[model samples]
Target chain A: MPVHPGEIPKPNTAWIWKTFWIITAITALEFAIAFVMPSSTLRNSIFIILTIFKAFFIVAEFMHLKHETKGLIWTILIPMGLLIWLLVALITEGNAIHEAIF
Target chain B: MSTISPTTQAISDSALDKPRTGTWDGGNEPFNASYGKLMMWFFLLSDAFTFAAFLTTYGLIRHRYQPYTGTPEAFEFSTAYWPIPEKVFNAFPGLHGFDLPLAFVALMTMILIFSSVTMVLAVEAGQRFDKKDVQKWLLWTILFGVIFVSCQAWEWSHFITGTDEGTLMNDGTRFFGANLAVNQYGPVLFADLFFFITGFHGTHVFSGICLLIYCFIATTNGTFEKRGHYEMVEKIGLYWHFVDLVWVFVFTFFYLV
Candidate 1:
């Protein structure tokens, strides 16, 4: 097939609008949860989980990572996944330090 | 070799004669991604770790100073050595004495997120080779980015000027707005970390806006159209979204949690 110069490819507008709404909805939910829910471990966990959900959508859909090849996807996701372990270890160490101090 | 069939010998011969174009030949995309996109991903990955370290340190120090009570509500309302985030961040611009906790930050968050949406739309326009649409969306994204930065500046100024003069401490001394040495808000470290973390993220936002402006000019000048692709817009879209992604985590760690 011959290609024409300066021709733009067709875009998926529906998908874009859908993703926009999804992100907006999650943000609204986050704000609502923050206002009404009492600050607790559970509330904190909810916030973290919601944040991850929003991050996933923004990365996958908006950043177009969802359409990338498996190898490329793993290249980015695997290293970021390890950061969770870092979070756990550091926070635990922080707790130990807190206990040791006044 | 003596045991090999004629077809097997032909197959082995062809394999041996095949061109040895190693992975570095630049012909093959091992991960099915272009060099620019792949490099951007790697940069973002490392950058993500930097932010993770900052937030984790924030958690470590904050937990040490946080006052705990049996009741969950008490934690939010606690007057412990650690400052309550809700209390410290509870002021809106032009709404004096309103006591609207997290309202301004929430507005800022929404603005950033909305900008992300516009960025994606711009990328979509780029995909269709719609130069005008791309310019329009990019302009909107840049406008929102500038608004977010201005709001941040206002918030910082309000913070530095010391609300209500100063909060009295136990030693009969009054501390004013945040500085490296002292702050009226909880521990001095709290103010330091807040400035460092948010300031770093805000800088990214500023840079992202600058990049968008360059892309905007390039688009108007027919750079992408001449090249027959809009990969530049797509690449920058990845960065714009990454900025938004980091803000989501920052909002969680600094504002909501």
Candidate 2:
């Protein structure tokens, strides 16, 4: 059979193996931060950072966003980006409610 | 050796050479689905909002408890106040006699995380059209999801049972122990937030378990293999992973913080 000219190679088996390794490493790092770090702003910062990294790996590789089109990634990521704004607005509203009751 | 006709060859070549689209979708335009892959993206987007709302509410309640803020033990739930998380959620396994903080919840978190690995393997098997492997992975995934849900249920039972015999005061109304009544835990609001946040996330885990069961059934039936793609597994995997992701935040905001 004739081959396609521009088509990318089908992702190899190694992709799954590599994905596992990355996820394992990120999870280990998260455990370390949670267990070893003394409570502080620094520990919190590290925890959040590692969490974001773990999330990124799952989204990019296991979810195959890296293989997706720009339109798809944006469709997914833009809303997540908006969550920051959502958090601020919701938290502010929640605070107001707390004030009224308190 | 040039045995195939030119038009037939051209059609085959075109099928092979088609430029890949930019989207993560499976590119099956005829069915109006790029494949179920893109569904994961959208699902995650919606899920993120749900979790964000819960965590933000938690923050608001915690911030209100600021001044004269006491240590974990000081925030104990008497007939008058709400208990602190470090105090409430620190149940260790039997025989430890030591109060380890966030122990069971931490273990639950690991269970969900490991379940995610099994889900990915299921997806990988689906891609290869390996029915046996798919069945194995999906079974393991379902088992793990069920275990995670059971753990959550146990925690909820403990939370609801409270220290005393399930009677608590809240804003002058007598509420049951299962609820976040006033004086059951420092502020009436703490139990309110805890129930709402963890409850919603637990519901998600429940649904994820259902989804996993369905996936397992479908895998055993060889549906995806017949469809010639395993995108469904990947799509559901996104939902499973998102459930785990939300737990991370819940653990941070509810337990650790």
Candidate 3:
């Protein structure tokens, strides 16, 4: 398993290009929505969803999280899942508080 | 031979020196990842939470100030105290008379994402031990990062200087520029959150650029060549991608939402 100096490892370049295009396309869609779509609940939801989708590609492909072992991936993703839950709960609670006081 | 007790013999065999095997063995990386990579993932996970917390607070405060209900059209013209994101962020650089809402920030987002692509390409080149390609892509990524930061500076200056000599509120207060106290944009909290969230993300981008520069230098000096792997490039690539990932969320929460 020893490596020699200046030895170039063969890499799969196809995935890189595919991911690049996918990210670019998603971003283009986001920009389109921003301009054409009016500000509304549905628009906000779409923005959130698309943002998460873009995040997934960056993490999975660029960061190589998808190539990691399940244990490692879960170690990262599980906490993020909990964080999302926390976000939902807090925002809901914040709304309730706002309604009660104001 | 002197009487060697079992406990003494076991003590003499250092645990660190022992050959590890099975589930408890160090040989079995639970996630089949290197130590550095695993640590980076953990760090990013925590950082994500920090950003989520900030955005969540922003949502809470925004909802409190501007409670929109019923039809979207009604809410759009509801005359809420909170500022509309598009209205506040409508300015484009050097386009004084034109109102290009979100166009410039959108361009900034594209630049950051494109930089992320270059970072990935750099990592790919590193995998192949293509020093020249790695350096090339890294430089490109750095250049993009610099451009994004400069664009941000211009945006901030424009925001601070105030358009149309600031907004005159019904409360008989003339609001101008942004600070911890007041902002001409709208509610004070909006400007505060905007500065804090984007400022934090900007710091990350700055540091990511610094890391890329260091990697570029090391690559030129044949450091990774001697190591026989471009793991350093991959590690920095993870960080660079995380920065871009955070910005995606920031863009959604701050600008688009």
Candidate 4:
């Protein structure tokens, strides 16, 4: 069935365009940090900050979870949460293997 | 239960039926998704986990070797220590004079990111039933994807056989200096990690290229036009964006960190 104007909600294209521009700017900042920053501490902080920003835009906008139902948001979020756990667990395992190899 | 019972109900039923024959109604079920869109989301979800695992593993390994490999490039630290990412990834095609540092990989990253943008634009155009825009943007996307894959293959070959003459480690060990193995550039374990992390990512790029081909064919055949929608564009957009997202992580963990 075709979606009626009343049935399906429309997303704000202006907001999407704004978010896209912001991400592009953030990417430029990230490149600067990677190449020009003299202080490693400052560069590391900037890199992590920009990375989180990019991830936020990806999950909220590109994935369309921002406008989705709570159930759908939870569906994607729960797996993402699990991935955090998996990263910690598996990477620790990889480290142990590295130790054994060394 | 009120006085206006069966007769009132009959009136409301007919009233609701009035719009049923319109173009917007006509037996169409709300929220019915195309297979491609659904599958794309599922694939991206799984791919996200795979990439997260790789980066996390890199983190763990780096941390475990902290004090030894940390401050790898510090001026006080011996030149014999610091791992130079630029030196490792430098690959120029049939050129002399100028030595490029990660230029090829950086270009590949840009291509994938731009293709992702084009893909989203294609989806937008698809929604508006703009077949010409969809075709144009998708062609650009396919071209970028193919170029990215080719560059990756060149990089892989460079890493495997390597360029210039170098000695093999007596024990078949591989390192980063005069010896075919083990000199500067952190623990030898990093080479293994490099191969695994990038090989897995290359596989994703390869599959994405295949999906783009399928999308290109479907668009050429007027499939989306006949369906009166652009669900396929949305599906491919998900896959394309996921590829870009993974690269963001790879760039940080592999290069910056």
- Which candidate has the top score in TM-score? 1
Per-residue lDDT over A1-102 for candidate 1, one digit per residue giving the tens place of the 0 to 100 score: 113546656666788778778877888898899888877899999999989999999999999899999988888889989989988988898788888886
Task: Provide the fnat value for model 3, as a fraction from 0 to 1.
Answer: 0.71
Model 4 share of native interface contacts: 0.26
Residue B87 of model 2 has an lDDT of: 66
lDDT (Cα, tens digit) per residue for candidate 2, span B1-257? 23457887788678676546646653435224364555556667877887887787676656545322455444445533335456677655462445676778878977887788788878776666667778898899889988988888888876776543334454555444556544355566777887888889889989988888888888778676556566777778888878887886777667765
- Against the true structure, candidate 3 reaches a TM-score of 0.87
Give lDDT: candidate 1, residue B69. 45
User: Which candidate gets the maximum lDDT versus the true structure?
Assistant: 1
User: Interface RMSD for every prediction, one decimal?
Assistant: 5.1, 5.6, 4.6, 6.0
Model 3 Cα displacement at B243 (Å)?
0.4
Q: Chain A only: list TM-scores of all candidates.
A: 0.88, 0.71, 0.84, 0.69
Better of 2 and 3 by lDDT: 3
Which ten contiguous residues of candidate 3 chain B have the minimum total lDDT?
B71-80
Model 3, A1-102: lDDT tens digits are: 224546767666788878878988888898889778777889989988888888889888888888877877888888888877877887888778778867
DockQ of each: 0.52, 0.26, 0.56, 0.26
Q: Evaluate candidate 2 and give its CAPRI docking class based on DockQ.
A: acceptable
Candidate 4, residues B7-97, lDDT tens digits: the string is: 7768867866443655575644323444455566667788787778778877776645633434325422122333556556667777643
Off by over 4 Å in 1: A1-11, B1-24, B68-80
